[model samples]
Target: MATRNIYYKSKTGILHWLGLAIAIVLLDQISKIWISHILHYGQAIRITSFFNLILVYNEGAAFSFLASQSGWQRYFFTAISILAVVVIVYLLKKHAHQRLFCLSLALILGGAIGNLIDRSLYGHVIDFLDVHAMGWHWPTFNIADCGITIGAVLFIIDELKRVRKS
Candidate 1:
């Protein structure tokens, strides 16, 4: 017998998930643009004991990997984001009825597209949110990063549930 798709069928339209992705991209872009306008590069404003608003750019993947390279990293990351977007879109289209899985994919898709837009326009990704601790600062990130991180966690959870059910 052919193996069946493990996810439950749903009535949710793929368009709805795509809408969510578009909303995320809009919010991320708007926030980044606003931050860029309000804060000079490398500027930071303390928002709380452990939080900050800042404006910075990343030319590489997470944690500044390859950031020291001579500008080649920008196009490299852009290509990677494009590939990820294509894969995510394909999965989203194929699994539109899987609510949770599709939701996770939509989040990742939005994030990839958001950073892709940044790479295309600025050759870097805009990062603002800064979380810190006692004399230690985590790498600054942005809304797109949040979406991608949350989506990854949710994707893992959904997959674990699916595996357990099988």
Candidate 2:
């Protein structure tokens, strides 16, 4: 079964994880604010051969999905983010004792709140930290994206390990 009951063995505190989430949110917001102040839109400052500190605004989901929509995507995505945050919080409380699972959920919760704050305040998410190479460019992203991505990966890896043991 793919249930979450497998992680009732270990006991990890929830407050620390929540604190980490809050710290992530603060860092993400501060970085976005600093970059927004330093660079205008469409400004790219090359930091390396394949990396840049660019300022870009995302009005859509990951990789600019649904970006060209007729202004409705903003509310849609905001609602989705809010819903995800709520669900993630519930999971965190229920599985707070599961260290890896809680860690992943906390990171995800932080990332969601970070992006959600942007979506509420700016009507879009401000993204910097551009990476490109070999004449190819990946989508510009920010700290929140990094947290969400790493958290998701860790979640998958933990689930895999649990499944293997069972």
Candidate 3:
């Protein structure tokens, strides 16, 4: 008689994805809280000539691109985030067997949830990391944005690799 391998088949992997997503959200939220309480808005704690820790509020999308749209951006961005979260969850459930794809979805889920918390609670997103050059400044961002960007890049890379493999 052959012994069947039951360990891998018995495992339910939802927790793995959920755990990673929650961890990312927690870290992002905690950092934002620390920045909000310890750093004044528009004030920078200079860590280096190129980088600074500055507390800024963003009501729009990446880099504060639409942050000055007469205050309607808050709701727009919030709606966009909610829709994104829903879509990501569906994709994750559908492709849970794909490790890289599922991980990317998890990262995006955490990031979207992190920013959504801010939009729902404070009506704006708290941004703290600042980069500067030539006496000019780039828009500040937080961990959630970094996670989302990284996840996006990874997703693209995964797709490219899949194509090459086939």
Candidate 4:
């Protein structure tokens, strides 16, 4: 059986994705701002036994990887983020009718935009959430990173559902 377009008559799908993306970006920025003003670098506000808010600045990709490349990583990361945004837009356009797919892409787009904004405006991404176990601490991350992580998981789930139906 063929799936008739569920969202052909309206642009709700596109708007939905755009809305989510904007919301994520806004929330990410606001949180970063709050963290910056409220907490000093390396200061931690313990939230639980395993979680804390640690003010951190990341100059590289996720997990603070390659954050110390003598300042050359900013442009490289910015270029990569731009490319990712282009690809995400393409995917959003192509799968606009697929709500789950569009949503997943939108989440990722928002995250990319969030971090890209940081990279372009500040030359670094601000990370705050810090999880730890015993003496080891997980990498700190922000709302944008959370958005990306959620989006990736949602994409995987959507794909699996589609496969199961097929």
Candidate 5:
């Protein structure tokens, strides 16, 4: 009689990664909701000498690109995010066993979905975190943006490690 190794075979599904993604989305949404409830649009609450909490509505991509354009950008961005989510899901499912790769995809998927929910519900994404120094202010962002940025960094690291290993 042969003994089956359940632990080895059970690592091939995306459920674990998907759960992480869902957690990120929930955290992003809850933070945004809390910010919205406490601050009026355009209100800035200084948290430190270099950091501030502000309410901003972004209608376009990163760094406010296309934000000034007529409302068409909302639907365009939403569609793009949806497509990205689908791709991420496929990648996650395909490489579930690759822990680092799946983790990167999960973070990106969560961020994308978080922004998608905002776009679908409010016609724009809510940004609250603000960083500034020496009279220069960085673009305001939120938890979703942080997740996406971190995920992108991790993805790069994973790729670099893979290339080096080969």
Candidate 6:
């Protein structure tokens, strides 16, 4: 007798992962909205001895790469994020049975879409969460950035586990 995975045989399983993605997007957007409503642009609110909540608008990729460039980078990054969402969706559908892989893709998909919405509407992504230690401050980031970073790390771990299994 052989064991069968029902999740891979039905559409509902895929929807379950998609739902996770949607939830991430909603949470990301809500957090951004709350931050915007409470904080003025470039304003920082101390949360802890080593952390603060601040408002920042990022017009470029991670760590504000190309943020100082002309306006063209906005369109470029938006397009790239849109393309990444498409790819992540496709991967999710194809490998939904692979729990960790699908989870990683779903998180990335949600994060990508969350930032994409901001870029399309405001030409920049809103960032609020900030961390500092020893007089050094890390770049400000938001929920979407957290999702993407965590997802990327999970993806690497999943790949390593897969390689080990093989």
Q: What does candidate 3's lDDT look like per residue over 42-102, in tens digits?
A: 9889999899999999988897878889878888889999999889878876666678887
Between the candidate structures 1 and 3, which one is better when assessed by TM-score?
A: 1
* Per-residue alpha-carbon lDDT of candidate 5 for residues 1-166, written as tens digits (9 for 90 to 100): 9998755644547999999999999999999999999999999999999999999999998888999999999999998999999999999887889988888889999999999999999999999999999989899999999889999999999999999999
Residue 148 shift from truth in candidate 3, angstroms: 0.3
Instruction: Locate the minimum summed-lDDT window of 10 residues in model 6.
Output: 5-14
Per-residue error for 87 in candidate 3, Å, reads 1.2
Residue-wise C-alpha lDDT for candidate 1, range 35-91, written one tens digit per residue: 999999999999999999999999888887998899988988988899998888888
Residues 1-166, candidate 4: write the lDDT tens digits: 9899755654556677788999999999999999999999999999999999999889999887789789999999999999998998888877787888888889999999999999999999999999889899788999999999999999999999999999
CA shift of 157, model 4, Å:
1.4
Tally clashes: model 2.
0
How far is 136's C-alpha from truth in model 2 (Å)?
A: 2.9
Clashing pairs in 6: none
- Lowest summed lDDT window (length 10), candidate 3: 6-15
Q: Candidate 2 — which residues are off by over 4 angstroms?
A: 1-11
TM-score of each: 0.91, 0.91, 0.88, 0.89, 0.92, 0.93
- Superposed on all Cα atoms, the candidates' RMSDs to the truth, in angstroms, are 3.6, 4.8, 2.9, 3.0, 2.5, 2.2
Clashing pairs in 5: none
Clashing pairs in 4: none
Ranking the candidates on lDDT from highest down gives 5, 6, 1, 4, 2, 3
Better of 5 and 6 by TM-score: 6
What digit string (tens of lDDT, one per residue) describes model 6 on residues 1-166?
A: 9888664475547798889989999999999999999999999999899999999999998999999998999999998998998888888878877888888888888899999999999999999999999989889999999889989999999999999999
Please say which candidate is ahead in TM-score: 4 or 6. 6
Q: Which structure among the candidates has the greatest lDDT?
A: 5
- For model 4, the superposed segments whose C-alpha errors exceed 4 Å read 1-7, 134-136
